[model samples]
Target: MFANIPTYWCAKCDDITQFSLKVKEPPQFTFAIRKAMDDASGPVIPYETNYCDFCCKNCGQPVRVKYDEHEFAMSSYRYLPKAVYLYEFAL
Candidate 1:
């Protein structure tokens, strides 16, 4: 269900804190633990996304993730609140 399951995310700091798009059913929620890292260069490297969790290194501030799926059949993108931009997220 890769194509059908379009999960979304939002970082608290930068990408240090993150969570995956949940079905919002009963006890339905997924989080992650894969912090981003630099590969030789100072540029940040991307990870194998589509899994639940946040890329800690990438997420730098403080964040609160929430999924906002509009197209239930196509793709989904989480709606990061403005507070997220100023969040002081910690592990």
Candidate 2:
């Protein structure tokens, strides 16, 4: 069984709706280093970060959700516009 997930207001849908959560994996890169004395390659290194994306089921609009943190509790969550979120993240 799946745990209860709360629905949020989707402006595009003009009503409350459930959102689908998708996790995006960061990009990976590989580098090669050559030694001055010999022609050899160095080890490969990988880096990545976790990112979450939410889409409204009714309207299929993407939104970025954030929780408001108070002194010791979370007050509420806000849906950020896709344009602003994309600009902020440079995605």
Candidate 3:
């Protein structure tokens, strides 16, 4: 897991806040596919990615963070729109 916690600008909170991330490991099939790809193409797939879910503690807005294990870096972060969050929860 990545050691550093990332900060994002929270629109609801109106301030930069540190996101408490929860790392999710990739499925076993992902490793199998990666290994097959590597064997076929000589280390083409170097990193196994994991997902991290976080939310703005102040606002309860959810976000998804992606991290790369080999690089030990955060690849990207996406803030879930309020409408989407509400719709999913409503179901």
The local distance difference test score of each candidate is 0.28, 0.33, 0.42
Candidate 3: tens digits of C-alpha lDDT, residues 41-87: 33212345443444556765554444444533476543322111110
TM-score of each: 0.21, 0.33, 0.40
Tell me the TM-score of model 2: 0.33
| Candidate 3 Cα outliers beyond 4 Å, as residue runs | 1-3, 20-47, 71-91
True-vs-predicted CA distance for residue 84, candidate 3, Å: 14
Provide C-alpha RMSD values for all models, in order. 14.1, 14.6, 11.8
Model 1, stretches more than 4 Å misplaced?
1-55, 58-60, 74-85, 89-91
Q: Residue-wise lDDT of candidate 1 within 17-79, one digit each (tens)? A: 223444221121123211221111122123212222222335333222322233434454433
Model 1 is weakest, by summed lDDT over 10 consecutive residues, at 32-41
Ranked candidates, highest lDDT first:
3, 2, 1
lDDT of 1 at 56: 35
Cα lDDT tens digits, model 2, 13-83, are 58675533233211211121112101221121221111234445566454433322123336443332222
Best by lDDT: 3
Ranking by TM-score: 3, 2, 1
